[model samples]
Target: MSSESSKKRKPKVIRSDGAPAEGKRNRSDTEQEGKYYSEEAEVDLRDPGRDYELYKYTCQELQRLMAEIQDLKSRGGKDMAIEIEERRIQSCVHFMTLKKLNRLAHIRLKKGRDQTHEAKQKVDAYHLQLQNLLYEEGKYYSEEAEVDLRDPGRDYELYKYTCQELQRLMAEIQDLKSRGGKDMAIEIEERRIQSCVHFMTLKKLNRLAHIRLKKGRDQTHEAKQKVDAYHLQLQNLLYEVMHLQKEITKCLEFK
Candidate 1:
């Protein structure tokens, strides 16, 4: 990324209320900024089938998160815990929003890239194959599902599925291993996770900043109104004092 764009990329410091945490970064601003989701580091669409599965999983995770967030909103509770939960939900939503955009972009960019009917057929076949595998295995989530990419290896189900997929791919495709197949798969997953994290962090911070800024504006407006009220009260008092002095002068003249 250019230095100019880098500077425009402000810090991500979000609180639970979708506001920026004071004097601190949200997430992406801390360490993993500019890792991925850049113009240069576009989404990889070489393996359309794999990308499609990942895209579907990303959508599913987003849906699940949104539902949870809605539920949390509806079931509002007291105090700090609720506040913390809100922040967590806001952050996740921000992250997933970015992920969804990128995944969609990848889908669009890869469109018609595979001109051949055979290539398209294979992609479709792989997609169907994955769906079948999940159904057969009784799994709702995929091996590639990025439920939460912020904490790597926490999505054990996804990691396990990925490892299994890697093993199978290695067995079936001999030439792929020469490119450090399993290791490459792991690396790609990590990078993919980081990319999502990086984007999510950015959006979270932006949203938080906007919320905080709006709050600041509101406070400023309230303060301005208070100042205006005080000024009006002082003017009224001064007017009364002038009237009393005039009456005193009239009384002295009459005497």
Candidate 2:
């Protein structure tokens, strides 16, 4: 009956990978130790996926001191070093944030360069196709001319019509060449404008990232000052406790 009740009362357990498992109702001493180790593993912090998540995590670390501070106060204990260490961690958080921003900037810059290269490649491909088309057209004309030279008795009217068609094609080829040059120049200008815009946007992001970093540092500094004040207050309180104990001892002796 006791074993059944214990099993019913056991809560479900979750692993670090977030999988749920059945909790054991009873365990031997070794199994209990293994369970404690598993719990420790499950409690390990996971990697933060985003900058905001990392920032939130750091903020949580700072806020977590409230519980610790309360427990210390209840115990009449002073541990100011934890607050100081937290301040150092906050400073490192800002540095990591800056690195994240720099990494984003590098990624964006690389993307822009890749896009520009792809555009250039596409233009080159189009130019190559145009050149191939012009070559094929010229080959057709040369073949027609060779046929005409080999047979002078062929219809003069047909030969004249072919010449006219050849001239029209040549004019069209010249027009295409001019248009292609203009189109390529426009594409180049557009790419340059895009590059400039990306650069300006990256600069703006960097400025904003730094501004946030400064704000976080200022807040951390303020928190550090507050922590220092609290530490001093705790020290004063401890001194008072010591004085009161000394006075109590003297009174007991006098009695």
Clashes of each: 3, 0
**After superposition, which runs of candidate 2 have C-alpha atoms over 4 Å from their true positions?**
1-182
Q: Could you give candidate 2's per-residue lDDT for residues 201-245 as a string of tens digits?
A: 344344544555676798899999999999999999999999999
Instruction: Provide the TM-score for each candidate, comma-separated.
Output: 0.30, 0.30
Each candidate's root-mean-square deviation in Å? 36.8, 43.5
What tens digits encode model 1's per-residue C-alpha lDDT throughout 92-191? 7757656766765655445323323334455457657878898889986432233223333343444555556555543443333224323454554444
Q: Please report how far candidate 2 places residue 103 from its true position, in Å.
A: 36
> Which residue pairs collide, candidate 1?
12-26, 13-26, 16-87
Q: What does candidate 1 score on TM?
A: 0.30
Q: How far is 218's C-alpha from truth in model 1 (Å)?
A: 1.7
Candidate 1 residue spans exceeding 4 A from truth: 1-186
Inter-residue clash pairs, candidate 2: none
Give Cα-based local distance difference scores for all models.
Answer: 0.57, 0.56
